[model samples]
Target: MKLPILSQEIVITLQQLEGIGNKTILSKIGSIVCSSISTLDDLLSFWGNLKGKKFEAISNDDIKEANRIAKRIISRAVDENVGIITYYDEEYPEILRQCTDEKGKIDVPLILYYRGNLKALQIPGIAVIGTREPTPNGVKAGEYFSGEFAKQGFNIVSGLAVGCDTTGHVGALKVNGVTTAFLANGLDWESIYPKENLELAKRIVANNGLLLSEYPIGQSCGRYGLVARDRLQAGLSKATLVVQTGVTGGTMHAVNATIASKKPLFAVEYRNDVDISHEKVQGNIMLIREKGAIPLRSNGIDSAVAIIRGTDYKQVTVTQPSLFD
Candidate 1:
């Protein structure tokens, strides 16, 4: 019997299967945690044994295919300058490991491929996301809320997409506050979506912030990529704030994911002139009126900060900014 931590190659192999959405990867890695798994080859054989006995081994081709996928993922990460951190790795963020569901199930990710300052993971943070194509009111709300949140010393997290997501990052940066962008594409911090935000991404990293992803390099920003990306946005913080979103779209997806994960949500209130009755604002309102997501206030951010720090508003002390500030 050996320790999983001793077999670096096994940990790497498990990370390769991260986005495969397989129960086998979970069980195989969980098996390696304690008892006696020894060498890298032994860990491989353990997975192989599970496939053979617990699961019928379809063919040698399966193992070959798995290895091939692993190589491809790694190659892309190398090309993009992405750093892959397995759950077993010391660099994996500690806050995420503490998530507990209603049933006490932890929603820990297998690996987190990140780019930019790794130190940002240790800092307290909040997320802001909403409609992809926001209206004027939504845009202002996102920016205003983000700027104020950053002022209060909360590191911002967003999907790095357009509309509410990008606005949040921009607002935080405007105030000389730290902000992190989570991407759905490859780990290469060099590229960014909308190509318009490429410079914005650089500014974020330059400001001592981070750009992170779970996927490999050159991975297309597709449906699954966004879904995987959304989880990081929601789970990386104490609360999620939606400036605007339609009843049936990206904002809705993010809001629902946050709810499932049991994180708090705050939707910006509708403006008086904009048709609050429109479908775009429906989701935000629903979260407030039905699902119990709190409403935004001029002071809502202060409340959010208190919640995140687990301190009363008066008890919350301020900290000095680093070089990024």
Candidate 2:
């Protein structure tokens, strides 16, 4: 049977079914499954109708599971004022509509749960990402670069991880500029991973910045989620600044996505006379020498901003209220 047009609530409920992860559903399963199945009933019967009766994600015993899932998510949404924007929704950021994973596959998220100003999504954003265990130089670079970009009217995009990510958000905060934090876990207090940053998350909202996550209220961030969510940092930005990173780690994932998207990448370049070891700046060194990334030395934000403006993309302005009710 047919169901009403795929609603945000229905999309969340459908996610609870087995074999329906975000990457697989949107990329691997393709649009055929989404086009064929309008609701939960179609989830159980679509394969059966095409393949055989035995083909299904769940049996009759779990028929009500979707309802239960929807109830929990909706209840939390009401309780915490969390809002959801899905792939099909017009409010979903166009920058993320074609997010590319590490392998270059189009792994767009099916939905994102958000809190704070939706207006921030309308601004052109530049991602400032780097190591979680940053050197003092990384910290200064992260904060300085973010503050400079924010001063110029570009929103900052980053994960809410400590070290560089925290500095990025705080830099924007320092300037009262808009920033967006793409989290690996849910936006709810209970599930806001790294309990230490709960206050930082709150500050972002209080300052009219945005908090975004693909996970719902109860899920904690795992290693896989941490890695998978990196693409989003690069995906949301016009260009990216690698404040500091090692040769390989989660930050490289964002770097790869930025490169794959054909967006410019600028790596922080410390002076040769500076006492910092090569180990700490290996990522920056390698990127500039081998990866064709731009060298963003200290206080070179003018050049960085110049290159960013040279890109061909239209600015978007959108107005919307924050509260779901």
Candidate 3:
């Protein structure tokens, strides 16, 4: 079968596989289909016709949730002018293509529901995520790096949540740099969360940044949705930095995803003791020790910027543009 036909068929089939992980199922099918497996029927038969196999046990409510997501995506795609990006789409991030499985299955998402311009994917991005409620130190550090990283030409990415995440976005804006917010809730590309950042989110777009989500527009925010959102924020970036987190927090999820994707992960370590309740600290330590993430210097903004920009750490001499006297 044609590649487009096969890809389309597999997407629909994976979409219908209740209780099956969409990414996992798509990964499997993607491996075969990408390798010259002919058609959906041939692919299904090869896999023992797993398609349409009823789950041994699942409530109607569970099925309804899946349907709700599907329907919401469809309705909002039309109603809110959203666009659907499948793994096969040309605009799929090339960075994610590096994450191939042992069986040659890529970690690419099956589909990404999007509502904004695709330009953000081409820019070098740094994700900053941490506890929802941060300490004063965490908040200060988050702002510092956010501005520093943006000045280095890295587009800052974060959940639009309060605390460190929000600070990251604002810091980027303070430098007059671009930033993108990846949301956990289903959002029309134009929508902003926490209501307060609504203005900030607007400024980002006006500055040629974007607001993005994988969920269909209008889907309610859920715990799992936030978790899913974190993965995308990590996946979409060249590297990630956790400014401050408690022993357990969503920042860890983003860190883990960065590790699993084999991208560079870095942590901003405060000189003082980081609290466990903050939920981002332990994860950062674990990532550094076990996952090999580097510990970034708290005071080396210039050095970090030099490394990112591939230039010497010296301040550049500004050349004044000549104007009519």
Provide the TM-score for each candidate, comma-separated. 0.80, 0.85, 0.70
**Candidate rank order under TM-score:** 2, 1, 3
lDDT tens readout by residue for model 1, 151-261: 888889998888888899998988988898988876564445657788888888888788887656776677777766676777777788888777667666556667777
Q: 269 in model 2: Cα distance from truth in Å?
A: 0.6
Instruction: Identify the runs in model 3 with alpha carbons over 4 angstroms from their true place.
Output: 1-21, 28-72, 98-106, 189-193, 272-293, 305-325
Clashes of each: 2, 0, 8
Instruction: In candidate 1, list every pair of residues with a backbone clash.
Output: 1-36, 2-36
lDDT of 2 by residue, 77-173 (tens): 8788899988867788888887888778787888899999998999999998888888776788788889989999999999889888998999999
Clashing pairs in 3: 245-279, 245-280, 245-281, 246-278, 246-279, 246-280, 247-279, 248-279
CA lDDT scores, all candidates in order: 0.69, 0.79, 0.66
| Error in Å for residue 275 of model 1 | 5.0
The weakest ten consecutive residues by lDDT in model 2 span 316-325
Q: Point out the worst 10-residue segment of candidate 1 by lDDT.
A: 316-325
Looking at candidate 1, what is the lDDT of residue 120? Answer: 82
